[model samples]
Target: MNILAIESSCDDTSAAVLAPTGVLSNVIASQSIHIKFGGVVPELASRAHQTTISQTVAQALDESKLTLDAIDLVAVTQGPGLMGSLLVGLCFAKGLALANHIPLVGVNHMDAHIYANFIDESPSFPFICLTVSGGHTQLVHVKAPFEHEILGSTRDDAAGEAFDKIGKILGLSYPAGPVMDKLSKEGDAKFHKFPQALLKEGLDFSFSGLKTSALYYTQAKEDAWVQEHLNDICASVSEAITEVLIKKLKRAVQQTGVETIAIAGGVSANSMLRAKAKKMADTMSLNLHIPKLSYCTDNAAMIAITGKMKAELGEYADMNMKPFASL
Candidate 1:
């Protein structure tokens, strides 16, 4: 069986082919246009998706050594993302399914992130997943295949959002999360302590306060000083954000008593967060699973694999299905 999937939930336009054993081919075409804006522009993102979607899918199929007729299932991200971007992917996917007479599966963007861990590994049932990304930060308890209960989520800014927003204050490039993470590796995480919001609160998170604090802190400093201490400042910001995430994960483990755990979504690729998760897993004698860097972000492979899972359960979406923009 061949499953072709498309993911255009945000900036990048990606497509993938999933063979029975695993992903046969994964192709991504990222939009560099948003760099100057220092953030994603919805109109630009949708236009980019429309421009790249066809070529991207063709490349994925070509890489997989499969023709459009060979694909048996078509999957697409249905929502919890930019509406225009989601529509671009969905329209393409629906066309493929209709033209080929193949089955269609519309997957949730967040659900695909969790299933990304499944692509490389099979974590035990009832594990905990801490999914942190630019648009969302959530802790989920996965009891079984396709069965999940959200334990907690960000009430304000997500962890990744905080990273990028704070990075912008530091005069970093757009999509500053990766830049900051790289810079943080060489600096001291204790250089300046940033506040951890809702530390004692339940599983819910709040990074808005942290962002505000960073804004004020940087506003008071000279641009020269901030640039000189860029690495240290990034490290300190990372420390503050990750500390809270780890704390919440620990609390979730204590409350749920789940011995198996994992992290997913874009921010799961953070070096500091990954290292901290590893240490915690080792210290707690827990089985830990994390997706490779490719799978950590929005990609079609996760959507493909998730579509395959749904196909196995006889789940299918009809042509009447529509894309949504909320989680």
Candidate 2:
């Protein structure tokens, strides 16, 4: 079956084609317009999606060596994102499905992130997934395909959000997570010790305190001092965030007794998180699954693969489907 998917959940406009074996093409057009704003602008994001969706879809098909007629299913992200951005992709998918007489499937953005790990390699059933993105930070227990139990989530700011916010304080560019991760690699993570938030029990997370701590850290120093220690500061921030995440992941593993684990979403692309996860996995004798960098961030391939899975189960959305802003 040929599945065509569109993902405009946030800033990037993406399209992908999925086949029985795997994804054939996954094209992404990132919006550089939000750089100056230091964050995503909803209106600008929706407009950008409108401008790029058609060409993006065409390029995806071209890259896949397939035509619109080959698309048997149209899948789109339906919720838990910017409403306007979600609407652009949802309406386009619905229209395409109507015109082509193809099946339409509405996928949850978070669910797609978890399923991303299945695109190339499959984890065992009942594995734990720590999904950390700009908008969300969650630990989910996947019992089976399409069946999940959210073990824990952020109480306030997500880990990625904290990263971007702290980066702004350091005068970094917008979408600062990647830049912060890169900068951390050149400095000492132990140079500055930041507080790690723990819930005292269970698996929930909280990064709001960390962001506040960073705010005070920057305010205490002059611009010159900060610039001089930028790399070390970034490394310290990365250490603080990843330390909490890894600690909770280890606790969850012990509590759930699930040796198979994975990490998903954009923040999983952080070098420190990846390295730390590998070390922890080895110590615990756990099987770890993490998607490639391409799959870690928001993309259409995850949506298409998820759509294919739902299609096999006869899960379809009709003309009445609507987009949502929260999970």
Candidate 3:
């Protein structure tokens, strides 16, 4: 069966076609407008989705050599995103499904991130997945292909949010994780040691204190010195954040006894995090699974693949399902 999917949860507008074997085509059109504001504006993002969704879907179908009529199922991210953005994609999917007489499935954005690992390669069941993104930080125990129990999550700001917050202090643009990750390689990571807050037991995390620490440290520093050692500051902050994540992941893996470890979500695209995860996995004698850089971020192909998996498992949402802003 062929599935067509749409994703417009935040700043990116993406679409993809998925077959039983794998992704046939995936197209993404990211809005550069958010760069100027140093963050995503919900209204502007929703407007951009309205303008880009059709073209994105068309491109995916065209590139895959398939037509909308040939699509057996229509899937779209329904929640845990901006309400306006989610509405655009959900409405479009509903309309398309009604017009084409195909089934419409609502996919969770976080679930899609986990399924992204299954796109190119297949990881066995009962694995531990650490999903870190701009809006979420979670350690989920995957007992089966579609079965997951969230063992831990961030109580305050997520890892990506901390990166972007620190980026603002460093005078970087929005979506600053990538920029911070890049600059870290050029500077000394030990220049500044930020605090890592290990919240009340379990695998849950809290980065708000870390973010606040960076803010106050930057504020207390001399303007001239801050300018001179910007790279070092970025590197130090990134290193601290990565260390906290790795430390928590190790604890979770040991507690769960799941030897296979996987990382997903936007922040998983970080070079330092991936390298550290691989190193830790090897040292601990655990299997590691991470998606390619392109699939690390939000996209519709992941949603389509996840929907396909659900469909095969006889999990289908009724038409009464609605969008949610949070999980």
TM-score of each: 0.99, 0.98, 0.96
Residue lDDT tens for model 3, 1-327: 899999988889999999877789989999988888888999999999999999999999999999988999988998899999998888888888888898878889999999899988888778999999999999999999868899899999999999998898778888899999988888898998899788336788999998899889989989799879888998898888888889889998889898899999999999889999999999999989999988999999999988888878777766676788884
Candidate 3 Cα errors over 4 Å, as ranges: none
Candidate 2 residue 310 Cα shift, in angstroms, is 0.9
Rank order by lDDT, top first? 1, 2, 3
- lDDT of prediction 3: 0.90
By lDDT, who's the top model here? 1
Residue 324 alpha-carbon offset, candidate 1, angstroms: 0.5
RMSD of each: 0.8, 0.9, 1.4
Instruction: Give the CA lDDT, 0 to 100, for residue 311 in model 1.
Output: 87
Inter-residue clash pairs, candidate 1? none
Give the Cα lDDT of each candidate.
0.95, 0.94, 0.90
Better of 1 and 2 by lDDT: 1
Q: After superposing candidate 2, which stretches have Cα over 4 Å from the reference?
A: none
| 2 or 3, greater by lDDT | 2
